[model samples]
Target: MTASSWLLVAFPALGALILLLAGKRAKAWGHLLGCATVTLAFVYGVILFFAADTKSTVDTKLFSWIPVSALQVDFGLRIDALSLTFVLLITGVGMLIHFYSIGYMENDEGRYRFFAYLNLFVASMLVLVLGNSFVTLYLGWEGVGLASYLLIGWYQGRNSAATAAKKAFLMNRVGDVGLALAIFIMFKYSGSTGYAQVFDAVAAGKFPPAAITAMAILLLLGACGKSGQFPLQAWLPDAMEGPTPVSALIHAATMVTAGVYLVARSREIFNATEDGRLIVTLVGTVTLLLGCVVGCAYDDIKKVLAYSTVSQIGYMMLAVGLGPVAYALGIMHLVAHGFFKAGLFLGAGSVMHGMNDEVDMRKFGGLRRKMPITYVTFGLGYLALIGIPPLSGFFTKDAIIEAALGQGGWRGWVMGGAALLGAGLTAFYMTRLMVMTFHGKERWKDLKSEDGRDFHPHESKPIMWVPMAILAVGSIGAGAFFALGHRFTEWLAPSVGETVEAHHLPVEAWVISVAAVVISLLGVLIAWLVFRRDVPVERPERVSFVTKAARKDLYGNALNEAVVARPGTWLARALVYVDNRGVDGAVNGLAAALGGGSGRLRRLQTGFVRSYALSMLGGTFLLLVALLLVRFS
Candidate 1:
């Protein structure tokens, strides 16, 4: 079993390599190969999960990866509950997405290449979760970044896709720097970057509290960047410029969750630093609100869902920020989110497929009759996302809300209130999405698409809806299955440790749950009352200040430009000026002076013998006069 661990990553990686190398030869079967590889990985992971005693850590040492002095790193796999949980999510959902993409991208000429990139992404994500050391994780971290850049920019002809890919890549690099620096610090202080070594050192109080706090904060910075949290979140919504399947894969299953995984995996570091934990909590709270508020204003189906992903991930970050008491809960939300969010995205894809590839929800209404499978599946996912009872989100999300309120005091009230408010807003926007797209009168009846095509709504083929149906089922039941009898927390205890539930709550647990349900209902009611009447195909020319702000993503991009981008650009230009004028001018001036002095000296070097003879005679006479005067003195 230890030796076989490598197969987890090997399968998809092999598939990707073959797809790329075989080129046109593999085009006929490329999508099949991609789906088969992920399916095989899922099968292996399930077998491994049931076959092994998950209560303990399983480290499979392949070889010495880095054998530097005092820094011995092993190329190994970490097989345990946490890693396996992500493995299942990635491969299982990845397989479905791969299958869905077959139908989604069937007519596209580069479908084979697209599948190869997907396979590579899956393999990179596996490496990220399964690696035993930070360096190995970084290797996969970079690989995921590269694969996402490729996949997001898959349509090279579109400037928006290309620009969005670069934006996502650059923003993530800001966070990756934090992660890289934290690893360097870990190596410097702990003398090792492997999980066990650094963790053991931390447990022994080898690192100072300040150092620990720094590490935790740095890691959080990276998490925020990858997860689309505050100040680093501007890239995610724009990333919808990619294909719908790419959006589903990145937002739901793999990339966005990487931040949560990083935090949960490093629970020990966070547990040691109250300041770090508090800052993380604050960032999460702010981000959730940002995502929710902005989500309410978007007409583009994919961007709305993208912001929803941001908001949901913010919930997970908040849960984990509460420390051990909610680490498993955060992860639970992540898993639940993977199901419902993926379904939502795929459903959006279905809507687009039938509606002339149009993304504007304003152009859609009463689509449920045209695409019943999509409507049913999407509705289930919507219910699950908004915390409707007995759905996955009700089980997972309410737990997080309960955990927040349980923290107690002003901190509890503030965070818990913020979370509840976010919940309400989440319901509002999602309901708005549903009401505008599926509940109201058909808005596209007399309208033509931006591409001047007729609207002919139809159901997607089984190849696409089958995956949505599966994900919808998961969206409905996965939360309950993971939450029942404390099973998820217990299963995760071996890796993340047991979370001691906060006992001194400001309010009863049932109160939080009831309040959450009421707020969600209220949000839904308000959206129905407002949007169920008529949503204009064109945005209103005039709106309130708040509405305008929300539409602008709360000025997040502008803030980034003002605070980071424009200043950085100016600084770069300033640096170039200084290099040219200050540094180069001095060197050039010195060269000019030497050249002029050489020119004067060259004049004395006359080619004529007469000038040489005269110069020699004058030199001899001056020497003789100086010698005579010295003798007289």
Candidate 2:
């Protein structure tokens, strides 16, 4: 909370540097070091959490980073309730994942290297949340991106992993463009990217509505990229190609949450315009539906979870985008999601570990008896995820739904219905996942490991299951605790700004809450009936149009290729042609003409004295003839 709070990031960053630099020498001790750094960070984060006041914000200038003629960007940290909340989530979840990784990745030769990347990511994310200026935030933003690329492609031996990494990097680049432009816009109008200065300027009515709206849209584009919203969202599910721990920490818990944090952090600019919030709501609605449908088609355990993550982020976006009453609701969901999602992912990893590192849920069955701890933890997480009453998801997700419906008129009906439907689909897909993975006939009995040995499914060790258990506890309690007296919303107000009061919903609060529970249970019951006892090992070729489309990522890739990627390719080719034919041709043609002329002119410079004398006599005769003609004329 004081000057020393900088060490929260410094510790992990230094740990990563030393481990990477020491190479083989540090390999044996590197995992321990990595865990220690994050643990220390979490400790400091907790300390700062208690020390930080809900009513105040502090800005600490570390040093002058950029001092130019028209701009000054200082490297400083912003310590406030909102940033602290994110910091705690990042470091706390990061620590648990790091510990879990020690057990899961123990045998890999690159275990130390994995730890290094993990530590680096923690440090980068910390900086991103704590930064006081846009430039500083961007520095951390890019750092997180680079680390994600490295982690997601951890299995470099596989072409798919490499491709997935590139996809993530490139798609994020598409989003990063929006974030960069937003920053430029802020700087252009306000002459500063410092949070306090720009926000103050905005509050003072300095910028016009159009300009503020533009900034909001651009920032939302950036959010869509990082948070895995529509159009820019195809990358996040693909990010599962990395280690499961990476999925738990980066994709599920920390890094993907960056977009929500960004929007919440810059709420002032967004508050200036209604269009900005509406756009956010639209993107969230579409993405949640997209993720929900896609999730139903994936048999890969991790891919299902990946798509689920996409869906959940959509909910968060929808909540925040609703504006005012929903900002706190969005963050509340985000924090609760951090717990259950991490637990679910780690539980998935445990499932994989037991079945010889397999990811196909169709090949798994009756794992409940074998992995008790994992089953219990995953079950709690599942309940939380389904938004069952009293669990985290219920309290947080219900608030968003109620708020959306509270909008009234057609917008409320449309947005609220989308959220409500997404909830049912969420339950349906997740329940389907649970049934296929845990309750069905033992499909693994007939399968063999990649090494051709009989599969013997078993539970992970204490180190792994312990963290999941803790997270499961969080999954159960976090939402209820935050929902109590709206404690979390009040805590975050000083930093995230106040919510405007909105009209109540047409339905009663109890009715809305009851409807959510009923819808979720219906989905679960249907899935139980459909998938509890039977599953197909081979995927069906002929199915419904919805199935086919969902299996193809709802044709998002095709759309991108048709709409964005192909057009981009054509534009690039056109630019290349211009460079070659127009620009280069002009220079090349002039050079060729000069060369040819010089070659022809060289023939006239013969160096013979006799030839020169003859030429001189011929010249003298010609001169006399000219003089005589001139005289006569």
Clashes counted in candidate 1 amount to 0
Off by over 4 Å in 2: 499-502, 613-633
Q: Write the per-residue lDDT of candidate 2 for residues 466-522, one digit (tens) a residue.
A: 999999999977966966856788888888767555566887888988999999999
In order, how many clashes per candidate? 0, 0
List the global CA lDDT of all models.
0.92, 0.90
Question: Candidate 2 clash total?
Answer: 0
Task: Give me the displacement of residue 330 in model 1, in angstroms.
Answer: 0.2
Write one digit per residue (lDDT tens) for candidate 1, span 1-633. 756989999999999999999998887999999999999999999988888778899888898988988878899899999999999999999999999999999999988989999999999999999998888888888888999999989999999999999999999999999999999889888999999998998999999999999999999989988899998999999989888999999988889999999999998899999999999999999999999999998999999999999899999999999998899999999999999999999999999999999999999999999999999999999999999988899888888888888888877888889999998999999999999999788989989988898899999999999999999999877966965758888999999989788667877788888999999999999999999997888988699999899999999999999998999999999999998898998899899999999999999987999999999999999999999999999
Q: What is the lDDT of residue 126 in candidate 1?
A: 95
Model 1 residue 514 lDDT score: 92
Cα lDDT of candidate 1 equals: 0.92
